[model samples]
Target: MPKWISLDFGAKYKLSRLKLWFRGDLEYKDGNYPTDWDVYGSNDPNPDGSWDSWTFLHHFDEPYKPSGLPHKQYTQEDIDYARSGIDYEFIAIPEAYRFYRIKFNETTGNGAFIIITEMTYWGKLEE
Candidate 1:
């Protein structure tokens, strides 16, 4: 099954950045971290039916590696770093969106599951 998550801000806002944190786990780690993902934004509350209005906000050509250390051998600092989500800065676009979606295509070790500890988005409300 494909993995995805969506968020509705309830009202349109000028988004600036997004943050994602990975779960701290060494074993069964295939799906613990995402290797490829994309983010989309839309003004429509329901964008699943048609993605025509959804704008492609960002895409990762390469997987994100939170810690430089190996997955199984993570130091305390590495674990702490992983727990703290990494920030993804969005383009300086003035568009406002009420809906946001994140799609994950691949994970660490290519496991069948994807694990995320937390997710956060920062932006200003549309004036």
Candidate 2:
């Protein structure tokens, strides 16, 4: 089974960039990060309880695979990286969407769960 999270921007916007952080300042060996996933955008007026009328945005396949002792254990750099968050810029999307979603694949984590410490987005309003 796959898991996902949805976001309602309350209005339409031509999204440009997305910033994300996974499990900040915590044990990294918990296998609580997404390994494979995809992002989607939707403008359907009634998209609740459904996965319909969505436009594909991006796919993340192990975008950041933690390796080595420091990643498993503790390190100032690792903590800082988690705290700083990762940025992803979209590639020229002309469509503006009021809703966004991140759908996870079966390969997310070993424990079948994901932990996102924080997230943010940047975009301009659409007509």
Candidate with best lDDT: 2
Which candidate leads in TM-score?
A: 2
Tens-digit per-residue lDDT, 1-127, candidate 2? 3888888899999889888777654434455555567888888835465776778887775544333342345466555665667677888876899988888884433566777777889999986
TM-score attained by model 2? 0.75
Model 1 over residues 29-125: C-alpha lDDT tens digits?
Answer: 5677676777788887453555576788877633344555554455566556655666678777558888887878777667667877777878999
Could you estimate the TM-score for every candidate? Answer: 0.74, 0.75
For model 1, name the residue pairs that clash.
Answer: none
Q: How many pairs of residues collide in each model?
A: 0, 0
Off by over 4 Å in 2: 45-48, 65-79, 106-108
lDDT of each: 0.69, 0.70
Compared with the true structure, the alpha-carbon lDDT of candidate 2 equals: 0.70
